[model samples]
Target: MALNFEPELPTFVFERTYTNDHQFLFAFPNEKKMPNARQIQLRRLYDIMNLSVQRNDLPRARRAWSILARCKEINWKAMWRLGITLLGNDARVMESNPRKIDYLRTMLLQLPEERERILAELVQHYILAGKYRDALDELEFYLPSFPYRDNPVLHVYAGLLCIFVAQPPESAGVNEVEETAFDSNSLSRAQIFLEHAKALDPHNIVASEFLHKLHSISQGPASISFASHDSEDETHTKGCQPSQPKRKRSNS
Candidate 1:
């Protein structure tokens, strides 16, 4: 009995190697490997882009952004805001390069969530560039949609642009009949937009003021100066969202 009391020694012992890579039996092939060199580079580039933007180093940010945009793994649609900022941040550059507007227009389609906001910015840019017709066209194109249909500010913008375009040209060669017809159509469109704006936002002073101007125009020959209302519109836009700061005023 005493001789049989010796316990049998275990043949094998389980020990985990701390340095060994552990792979789960059900892990996917992609999950088992570390990030590829390209992935790491792309991640670094994103960091660079953000850092450069914060520092106001637009050129550097743009460089990084360009590279990142070309990467197949990067989702440019979600990154549209960054692209817009890079392309439109510099007032002089934007003014000199009309291509920036085209870029913004293209990017507008890619971002559904931010489409309304981006469209607003695009319209403002067009106004600043003295492209009143283009701005009105853009507003017309989008304002018929669901959320855009309800945007009071956009309606106001459209209304203002319409009034501006409706002004009779100083050129004497212009046919009176055609000019009258054009003005009539434009003023009608402007009236509708301004009324829609007022209906949407009863407290929108811009719409109220413009509507008054429209009424005066109908009574007699009246001059409604859009230049004076630019600052007012911008002020209201800023007040609408106190948390979000508006873009810098372009020197151009």
Candidate 2:
């Protein structure tokens, strides 16, 4: 008798193609199959890099770096994952691998096509590295672009990075007045980003979650010390709340 059970479908169709035997798994024919294969390799590369970090295996990490460098074309998502892998817990490895990061960034940014996509990945890299200002600058650079403006994820990321910018500076003797002003500015910017993201896609849970955090943080004693810059005329002045559309009642 045949078994009557069926497996659950993968959340992502292409993610199913990846396996531990990455080399053989991705050896498919033609460029059409390359996208899926490349995505698999990117994930595998992160594992390889993590292993390298755990074992302090420089040669293995180098091998992964070489493979990434040799890739003919890579998407923004892969680039973002690879950059995070490069910035893993291994401080020694990160210091030694600066060239790899530089190479990847240059390769991605220099590409004539999909500059916005590459810029988005770069923002991810900067954020992961705790370079919040750099991440914000990158987002601002692309903000005017229609593609960036249309993407909800970019807004979410910008808002997240802006929160980092609001963090208290590590330096001593930071004037309370100046710090408060900076915090207010950063929070306002973050609110705008999250609000825009919610407006664009009401169903985005990430944006919703960030908005909640923004509200919580805003009310916290630390954030309360900062002056509010919200305008009186705006309906959603607080910026934590998304405007809800009116529902029509119908006869049953």
Candidate 3:
């Protein structure tokens, strides 16, 4: 009888076993169980891009990012920060490549969630690149919109840019009527923006200082020297220095 009967197997012993990876896949069926060819390629490119950036190999990083940007599966909107970093890696290089600005503008359209922040950054970049008119235009275009209209910092930037463009060039010969009209319009706009900024954030130092300067400018040439005012304004608005003469304060 002992020879004829075999020992009963336990129920657990008969159950199929799954590894951790299998369990994970089972838990998240909607997720990809394994990387497809495209995903694998993208992952490799991402690694290369990050490593190249870390190594300061901008060319290599740009190449990798370019590929990733073109891929259909890639969510470039989510990766906009990385794109900004790559595009702005070299300030000198970026100055020559206007396409980078265009690319940022394109991203601005694609990333609605980050629109305000991106627009602010884009305006700052334009200011740094000595494109005062362009920066002001950008602010004007967005200032009527939802979030930008309410943003105090953006109002300050707009106000500063207005003051900048209002200044008449020292060497340029132009029609007196046109110059006067332009200056009048710009100063008016600057006052409006600065007042708006002050109203939005009363504690904003930049807005308050600029408002005072604007008021002093209105009081006539004798009340405030343009050279001194310009220098003081530039000091308050960091990274937005206009391409103007940096004159020393006259000691009389």
Candidate 4:
């Protein structure tokens, strides 16, 4: 038996690598920046959300508001902040948290009842999130109270909502609807919106184009007639045919 004694490193100084016990205690601190709860519990959700936006941690940033959501007290400014931050990928996270539904409902409700652009955005957000039911609910929430926009794109927006989002019919299709699938439904709704848009702003190309495209996609005629704007192009005037390819008059 050989005995070699060295001064013990005082147990504290001595180091042990792996604990023979597989269950040795080890600890790690939570490093992930969890949404700060107390900060946004009510008045602070806006601040936390702003911080999230500053970091471009849009998902977690928006999630921060889940803390104080359902309040419905956040006005258009706050709602806009949250609504715009919602991106395509955020939908999954939103679906996971039931808080998402509350946030959206409150957000839409808070927007000025007549703010069509915000309503469009709200619709777009719901559509991206694949919440068709919610999207439809949004339309129902908005369409009635909305003052008709004087925008040229108004019809396009309305048609899209009615046919695709709102599920309108085809037989009542607009003039441009040539006949694609649900040609009748899409055309009809498209016609309705486009007509509305045209009625609002007769010379708007955006409205004209949307109607033209919808009808074209449905196999309808490619042209539409509308009065030109103040800065109108004579060649592209309403009812004017596309210019023919000019032939080069070259003689050998």
TM-scores of all candidate predictions against the true structure: 0.62, 0.49, 0.65, 0.43
Best candidate, TM-score: 3
Worst 10 residues of 3 by lDDT: 21-30
The residue ranges of model 4 lying beyond 4 angstroms of the native Cα positions read 1-51, 57-79, 83-101, 113-115, 131-141, 144-154, 161-183, 217-252
lDDT of each: 0.64, 0.56, 0.66, 0.44
Worst 10 residues of 2 by lDDT: 232-241
Q: lDDT score of model 1?
A: 0.64
Candidate 2 per-residue lDDT, tens place, 1-252, comes to 976543332234234555544343232223344345455655556456456755767567756665655544433334444454554445354332344346546756566465567666666555445455655666766665667798887887777666655655435254653344346787889889989999999998877876886787766625432223232111111222122232333333
Per-residue lDDT of candidate 1, residues 151-171 (tens digit): 999999888777766665534
Candidate ranking (TM-score, best to worst): 3, 1, 2, 4
- Residue range 14-63, candidate 3, lDDT tens digits: 12333223221112112355755444445556667777777778898887
Residue pairs in candidate 2 whose N, alpha carbon or C atoms collide under 3 angstroms:
none
| Model with the higher lDDT, candidate 1 or 3 | 3
Question: How far in Å is the alpha carbon of 173 misplaced in model 3?
Answer: 12
Q: How close is candidate 2 to the true structure, as a TM-score?
A: 0.49
Better candidate number, 2 or 4, judged by TM-score: 2
Which tens-of-lDDT digit does each residue in 11-73 have in candidate 4? 221133333322212111221233222212332344445656666677776565553344343
Which has the greatest lDDT? 3
Q: What is the TM-score of candidate 1?
A: 0.62
